[model samples]
Target: MGIELLDRTALVLFSGGQDSTTTLAWALDRYDHVETVGFDYGQRHAVELEVRSVVADGIRRSFPDWGDRLGEDHMVDLQVLGRISETSLTKGMAIAMADDGLPNTFVPGRNLIFLTFAAAVAYRRGIRHIVTGVCETDYSGYPDCRDDTIKAMQLALNLGMDTRFVLHTPLMWIDKAETWALAKLLGGDELVDVVRTQTHTCYEGDREHIHDWGHGCGACPACELRATGYRGYLARQQA
Candidate 1:
């Protein structure tokens, strides 16, 4: 990355989840001005939307250095996406595998649509760099979260919008464990605590039970991945 890129403002596709929170911290560390964009797509885990402000406020309070770089936040109403998406994420159906072998929790074209909207916002805000946390290693077979999908979206966004917009996925190759480690690396224990207590990742949107890793239903795929990753992160820390 060039110094010019670092100096330019960045718009982060922040969903108030662990991955996006960490990515937000990553952007704050690199960019001089960092803005955030979240989508209210009517996901079953809508609670994540509620925590977005809390997480941002937590970061601002705990990391004053990075807080100075934090800029505006944009919340795009994408309820239409929920109306069209029949997946478990948008619906109240039980999480299961579809006949095509992919999990029902996979929201088709979610990241693609999200990137498109983020690009539009970035264009209006004069931001050239767009950061996201979509990863393939721990993506749970979500096609939209794949590295290839993100690259293609970046190309399409730039071509369709007639502007140069670079989509940055810092967690593209890292697993959940590495993601946890990245948060610690970016903002130390403070960032980790914010992510653990403030961010939401459970597919079922369960916040009642607080686990060692965080709050979740503890049985959902998301909660399982988060818990398992935290254990691995802890083990590595001990070593």
Candidate 2:
């Protein structure tokens, strides 16, 4: 691996999913010190924080001497900050369990709130880069995950905080297949194994029915996106 991304400190919005996991590994490769921030905004997968903690601690064991270098992986609880909404990811909402209607999973302003908090944390810690895993392609139609939204947040963060902070969506335009390829390209097989085996990506949170690569009911929007990526990946390998 050429590993161009190394030796700088970046604050990654790590979500304990494939995309964010890839971004975390990418940051680790590029930055000397890599810190991660996770928002616990009453999402269904808030339990994934436990997942992130395990991953972060494993990273620590790998580099025992670099306590400060790894930075902190924050799991900020935003339940009170979240208002009652229709999105399945928010408080006081009935999740459809499947992407049958409007995805009921659309937490409006989710990415916005996350980025806002992340930007604040980064500025306080004097970190400038905020890495997210929002990919416009092969997603479940989250408006906040779009490229325009991310750019707008970047501008707002700079203007609001009076600092030149950069919002880096490393997986912005890439499809799920491309994201998986990135894991292999940047993080190597070992990190890829870690990511595939861990990281929650299911609305149902059914880890038992999942393979090492994907999860959930296998019919929901998240499952569909993941399945699409899985097929694409297999096709690539076979091709």
Candidate 3:
């Protein structure tokens, strides 16, 4: 199922990657005030937060018609949550198949914690909409990226906080290729270039190596998926 766009002030859960960058543009297109909230959960790809800042700045500059709707960017430190988790993302362990059939990179409840914290921050800023770039179709075996999980979290947040906040997932039903298409549609070809070069998705967080999709450690699962999707997108465009 697809999510409907919200026409209100929003808080984007910006991760400084292709997906989140696309969603930031999506939110900016629909909302008047689009603030961003990032997390420092001790993930191996912490550099993506820095990329988030650059991309956010680029968005404000590129989309001047949106005015100063790009509000403050808030970064939360959730290092304690990462310290207790043994996921490859936070711990930098080898990527292996978990006994439960999930990827080793699956950070348990990472999105749940991120959305909960983001909602708290958004509520403080009087925002009721939270936009996230999570995509179930392109996700790397992370259950938290699923739509049902997001709905459940949204309901819980509303009940707990007594606020009617809507969680926006622009990429929830789309794959990485479609996400690329969305970036183009929302912010034109320039936004696509920004997402391609500035975003970071490597589980190993290797920014030195350039690939077709972006900069990433080619061997990692994230890079492999991104490369495959970019290839697909190219083929479709050519056809």
Which candidate number maximizes TM-score? 1
**Candidate 1 accuracy as TM-score:** 0.96
Instruction: Give a tens-digit lDDT track for model 3, residues 117-166.
Output: 99888778888799998888887778999999999999999888887888
Error of 1 at 199 (Å): 0.7
Residue pairs with backbone overlap in model 3: none
User: Which regions of candidate 3 are displaced past 4 Å?
Assistant: 1-7
Expressed as tens digits, the lDDT of each residue in 28-75 for candidate 2 is 777777788987766666666667876666555543544346777676
Ranking by lDDT: 1, 3, 2
TM-scores for every predicted model: 0.96, 0.86, 0.94
Model-by-model lDDT, in order? 0.91, 0.73, 0.85
The backbone clash count of each candidate, in order, is: 0, 7, 0
Off by over 4 Å in 1: 1-7
Which of the numbered candidates is closest to the native, going by highest lDDT?
Answer: 1
TM-score, prediction 2: 0.86
Question: Model 1, 1-239: lDDT tens per residue?
Answer: 21223337999999999999999999999989999999999999999999999999999999998999999999999999999999999998999999999999988888888998998888888888999998889879888988888888888887887777888999998988899999999989989999999899999889899988999999989999999999999999899
